[model samples]
Target chain A: MALITCQNAAFAYEGNTAVSNLNFAVHRGDYLCIVGENGSGKSTLIKGLLGLKVPQSGSVWMGDGLQPNKIGYLPQQTAAQKDFPASAYEVILSGRLGTRGILPFYSRVDKKIAEKNIKRLDIGNLRGRCYRELSGGQQQRVLLARALCAAEKMLLLDEPVAGLDPVVTRELYRLIEKINHETNITVIMVSHDIHSAVKYASHILHLQNTQVFFGKTKDYVQSEVGNRFLGITRRQESGGEAGGGEGSD
Target chain B: MIDILLEMFSYTFLVRAVIVGLLVSLCAALLGVSLVLKRYSMIGDGLSHVGFGTLAVATAMNASPLTVSIPVVVMAAFMLLRISENSKIKGDAAIALISTSSLAIGVVVISITTGMNTDVCNYMFGSILAMSKSDVILSIVLAIVVLILFVIFYNKIFAVTFDETFAQATGVKTGLYNMLIAFLTAITIVLGMRMMGALLISSLIIFPALTSMRVCKKFKSVTICSACVSVLCFFSGVVISYLQATPTGASVVIVNIIAFLLFWTANSIIRRGYA
Candidate 1:
């Protein structure tokens, strides 16, 4: 059985349907990138998957022993996170909160997992440092490690490289790719960076309020929708192609 | 100084006020860290206004003010949360709407019934003598409960405040924790109103946390520092008020402001050292 099945799922926002007719099945070890322009309902879909919002007309079913709390998520940064008075380790340790239902303290196991994630992400040096004090790339890495603490089977990231410079952006994408490959953890990333999305994702799920395309990466690139969107991305990114050819493995 | 302190504690009203004020400020400081970080510091001001309105109605009805104000202020907090979440009213606008409306209602109610009496003035601006024996007992018991609850749920509250979306995605039930924070805040505001005044109760919530955050880089340190700062400020504020014959709430706020300035200066100095 698929890990998650969204059968005609729709989410209402401000009395209007933000997104609808989402029909997708995420299987084990799938590197699915959700790509769309801003306001294209990618975030709504992520919320739906996280069980934060109930679908209007359909259901999002979790199967293959997957639960809502088990999915690791790295949401976009909020204003509260800026100048937040928490150490990077504390933020990362909080990811174990999913497994800590009703428990007041972080267990020894939880702490060990946090430590392991820190080591895994090579962020042990920043463990005790304040989160807000870290640079943007470092902060993203810390948050990614935090998401890793909760993600046993799958990782859900919403625009993880949104504000990062190209060098850092490429680094983060490759790191995510490495995680997906090494751990065989299924990855569902929402992004508008179509070039990197095509380069790293095994599958592409494009949205313009509804599914414009959902298939393997190669097929998506050949499809008319993919051709148009990639063309726009290429044109927009024409001047900055320094590391463009290197991502293709 | 010790003789003055002894003489000061000799008065029963001062002792009662000191005890209640310490506990209330402690609770306020603890909740303030999360509230300030979440940008809901205004919620304290808003709920204190609701507290004023309820106290006004309670006084007019010849009822126990604490009992009347506590639940009403809590409900108002929930309503404010709901309005911000579901309605077109954003957080600041919603708080402003509720706060101004409540203040107006309180003023109107007081003018119609009590005609600006000493009790009304005490509730509005705070008086040390306003901490009656029964109110002290109630405030202490409630403050202890608030402290215990806050300690037990500290981890969850930290997660929720720092990142509600991530916490909710982790299945932390952010709504419940948000409500929990609001509820505790309401209880603190209502309890502190008679001695800290509805007009000044929010300072007890905001100032200590902000001052501590200026110096402390971590949440645990910030919370600990804020608690100590608020408690120390409250004690000294009360003592100063007694010695100089000033209003309790205003003195405390002034002390907090001074502490904030000192800590901010120290923070800048420390950062410069690092640089």
Candidate 2:
């Protein structure tokens, strides 16, 4: 069963339509990478799917016992948010805020999940440390752990490796792949890194100026839209080594 | 110095001033962490100016200032938030525009209604005698309410202040909590204006939070330390005002300045030690 479905949806900001006529379904255990240009509304689509923004047209449906609150989100980091005064433990623990039943306090189970994620992310030693003082890779690890605590079934990440070094970025991608593969958690990631996206994602949603193509990774590589968007010829596509070719002109 | 302090506390008005000042300080500091973190600290200054304008009108109409000023200032706080959110005014600019205009209106009202009197001086630069017995009681009650509400919602506030978008995405009702913070800050600013004056009350809201952030990295620790620092500074400022015959509001702000410097120095030394 599909965990999430967006049917003929359109996302807008301040009456300006960003992306429209979007239709996609995310099944359980699918690693979906949403790749698009700078203003192609990838983040807006993610926001619409997460219920942060209402779709201007059509609808987004969460099924198979999935709800909006159960989805974890790791937003793109901003400089101001980076300076937030919080401990790594505190940041991770806040991921359970959605499940705490309006009591405004963390429960024992929440603490356990937070600790488990901390250990899973190998950030146990950084738990008590201040978030602002951590290195970029460590901070991203803490945030990823927080997102894990937020959703055990699904995770949505926006540019999670945007500013990290190549090594750290590769490590994060591996970690996310492990979570998706081992835990059967649905992963929908918005990324500018086309190389990593094609390498790891099971499914690819390529959004262009006025079009969106969603299909299996192999099929996407073979499709005309994919060939043009990924800048791969049919002969080179078979190799599966077309190193992160540029998107459509 | 001890004898003089004791004698100053012997006066009923001084006792009332101390009680109200300490309570207001505690509440201001408690909420200041979120305000500073959210970059809404200047809202205190804006609301205090609105309070001053309302107080001026109340005095002109021969009505109770607290009753008149509280609701008007609260409304202004909400308006400022709305304007900053929806309009092109933005945060700091909105604050500057609202505060300066309200301050001008207050000056005009005071001058036209009562001429150049001690009341104008008291409102601009606070006097210890500004707190009456009833005002003290009211301030204590409101301050306790603010403190209790803040403690109950501490975790939620922490989430909102850290990342408002994420908080809202997680179903935390970020709008309601933002309104709650604005409302509580309005009440604190109104209650504190008579003691700290319109111009200086914002310092009470900004200083303790900034000072505490120097030493504490966690929200809980910063909040706890801010409350401690606020109360200690208020007490010390009030005592110094009494003994040295200084303006109460100015004296308190000076104390905060000294405390901020001390904390900054200590934070630097500690960071160096760790390095």
**Candidate of highest lDDT:** 1
Instruction: Report the alpha-carbon TM-score of model 1 versus the true structure.
Output: 0.96
Question: On residues B1-275, what C-alpha lDDT tens digit does candidate 1 reach at each position?
Answer: 89989999999998999999999999999999999998888889999989999989998999999989998999999988787666465778878998999889988899999797787788788988877889989998999999999999999999998888899999998899999999999999999988889899999999999999998988999999999999999998988988899998999999999999999999999999999
Give one clash count per candidate, in the order shown: 0, 0
Clashing pairs in 2: none
Model 1 off-target regions past 4 Å? A238-249
Candidate 2 lDDT, tens digit per residue, B53-128? 9989999999989999999998998988787566555778878998999889988998999986999889988878
Q: What local lDDT score does residue A218 receive in model 1, on the 0 to 100 scale? A: 99
lDDT of 1 by residue, A1-249 (tens): 899998888898766898888888899999999988878898888988888888988889999899888999999999779899899989999999988889899999999999999988899899989989999999999999999999899999988887777788888998999999999999999987788889899999999998888889999999999999888767656656523222322
Q: Whole-model lDDT for model 1 versus the true structure?
A: 0.90
Error of 2 at B16 (Å): 0.6
